[model samples]
Target: MKKWFLISTIVLLMIINTNPASAISNAPIHWGFTKGKNEQQAEAGKAYDELLRKHHAFYKGDPNKKVLYLTFDNGYENGYTPKVLDVLKKEKVPAIFFVTGHYLTSEPKLVQRMVNEGHLIGNHSWSHPDLTQVSNEKLKEELKKVKDETARITKQKEMHYLRPPRGILSERTMQLANEEGYTHVLWSLAFKDWLVDQQKGWKYSYDNIMAQVHPGAVLLLHTVSKDNADALEKVIKDLKARGYTFKRIDKFK
Candidate 1:
């Protein structure tokens, strides 16, 4: 009876091990991603393609309307993401974070915190580069590198949006993003906050951002700089006063 029990256990282990669904995918995402010739092409680059994709909505209408979409690009891992999260929490607002693998692998807890706080995290590619010029294979690597790492960290299934590095886009880039199951999020509202200039204080940013505020505004800021994190609270208040409700840009909003 003991021998029979041991044999049953061994068989069960084998069955589970051989199942594709049961196995963890540890393979490198870069193994298949390649670079494209979009930049060199006389016409347009190849279309973007990926193994999976995720995005719920795009720009609904005119940019000058009442809605504003707040987004931040995460290139480097700044200790400030938590502070940014704190500000967002206090204001009860939702913003999109365009994140890179550097940020994901280095600051995983912050990513979890972002998810917990009900904010959208977008695939900002593995490395920050112009996606419009990369091949579909490379495009896959650019996105999955983060998605896979994020999955491992969050223990969650998947992410929804992907905005390529530098906000660069091409036919191939769009196709690749689509294939990867992501919506190519573009910003109708962005200013010098992307700049690293420290002189561009909260007042400068506030005025510039406020001037450009319209419906469905996908405002881009960086988490690495003291400027953005510092500007968060005041910006939220100013927008509130202007009668704009901070929200996720989607079908419902």
Candidate 2:
């Protein structure tokens, strides 16, 4: 009986190991990249490129195209989104806003305005938890809540893009997200601009952006930063002058 029990236990372990989900690493990866300069594209290195590509994710667009994709994280409103929206309206720039459940509930009108004004809304998870640490069911729940709430509020039936909460992800999370029809939208350009209390100035935001500007760059900005709102208009005008056309995420190649 003891010998048979040992054999059964070994077979169970083998079965668990062979499971597809179990085979992928759940080790969390905090997304980072080497900054691009002189108008060259930023490098996410080979491993990140491979992992992202395999999951149909996007960090940047075609390297040869002087096209930019602008995205904002809306975890919570800080009374500056209106200014940002106004700038986008004036300059006719397109952007995607990744919103959390809190944002959806707390600022439904703003979210509706986003859709009404031809901007795309993306899922930033329900509670903004580190997705790599959540179980498959929990992850699904988190995503579902945001998607459903977004649909209810904006009447936008499809939510295809997802920016992992806190920029944390893993192979397991990516695979799960892909299975849910969410294409992970990572960024190729970002800075320490999310800190609300540490905002330097509008020029600070502008300078960092100008320095990192590149072909096919995807920029991640926080709506909570007053600097971003203040500098947005000039940034758009200047980037346009530099011959960079801002494109919607859906139009990205």
Candidate 3:
């Protein structure tokens, strides 16, 4: 009887070790973007769009309106977010900030300020790993860690949106995130704003952003870019001059 019990325990351990949910897949397609003259410019293709819709993900919104949803990916604070916040406040524009574990732990005050100022704080995963390469267990943990911590710091119970780290995602990853009650939020417009030294000046940033302005554009700007911070006011002004309006991601529909 004891021998049989030992065998059963071994089999149980093996089952746990080989759980199918712990498996990872090599996702074939990395997210891509194509610059175009209108809403078609940032299309992620029909297949991709259907897949995202199956999992309730979004990169842009309301293709018929000239509205822009602004978001920032905050992997870490570089002392420039305050300026960004200032610009948003002065302009009365709303945005979402996708943050990591380090950003939450290191800049609790800034995180709090973001919450206080009526900006949405989203989960960017704990360590910013490529979720497409991780097992469902690890993927959930990565998202949950940041969500729990952000809630702890900001006193908010729900973090409803996620931007997959490095913009890497798979269909399975999106399904798992959806099961965890998150809407995957990707972007329609992004540039080299994350690299501090590679900044091409505020004018260059302004021109590039304006050139791509479209109906329902979800613009992803890195808060760490001083060029972005400096150019935000003018960017908003120009966008408004062109009849564009800023909106929060929750209001995308």
User: Best candidate, TM-score-wise?
Assistant: 2
Model 2 quality (TM-score): 0.94
Model 3, residue 204: C-alpha shift (Å): 1.6
Q: Per-residue lDDT of 124-159 in model 2, one digit per residue for the tens?
A: 999999998889999999999999999999968899
TM per prediction: 0.72, 0.94, 0.88
Ranking by TM-score: 2, 3, 1
Ten residues in sequence with the least summed lDDT for candidate 2: 16-25
Output the lDDT of residue 198, model 2. 100
List residue ranges in candidate 3 displaced over 4 A.
1-28, 38-41
> Whole-model lDDT, candidate 3?
0.86
lDDT of 3 by residue, 1-253 (tens): 9999999999988987886444534473577767645435577789888877888888878777989999999998888899999999999999999999999999999999998999999999999998877777898899889888988988666988998888888877877888899999988888778898898889978877887777888898998888898899999988888888998898988
lDDT, candidates in the order shown = 0.65, 0.95, 0.86
The parts of candidate 2 lying over 4 Å away from their true place are 1-18
Per-model clash counts, in order, read: 26, 0, 0
